[model samples]
Target: DEPLDDENLIDYGLDSVRMMGLAARWRKVHGDIDFVMLAKNPTIDAWWALLSRGVE
Candidate 1:
């Protein structure tokens, strides 16, 4: 299910294990990332911001 950008992912059943796996997968391609930071916000928009931080 695609969640709205502003929606809280935890509300949609996003648990820590899933979050960790996502972080691990993303890290493999994006380099080191703050998993806690992504987990803290738990929103699609926030995640995009984190992922696109250094990209122009």
Candidate 2:
């Protein structure tokens, strides 16, 4: 699906399992991340912000 940055991921079929998998994959490289919070704010912009938080 072509998602906009502010689009709700749930509206496009992103479920708990997919979300968990995404978090787990990210965790492999980024260390501990708040998956719950990420799920709460399910948007591309929010995801990018969360994932890039501590990077230079």
lDDT winner: 1
- Give the per-residue lDDT of model 1 (tens digit) for 1-56: 87899999998999999998899888876786657977889999988988887788
Model 2 alpha-carbon miss at residue 52, Å: 1.3
Candidate 1, residue 9: the lDDT equals 96
Clash count, predicted structure 2: 0
Model 1 TM-score on a 0 to 1 scale? 0.80
What tens-digit string does per-residue lDDT give for candidate 2 at 1-56? Answer: 68899999989999988899898888877787657977889999988987887789
For candidate 1, give the lDDT. 0.86
lDDT at residue 27 of model 1 (Cα atoms): 88
Candidate 2 lDDT (Cα, 0 to 1): 0.85
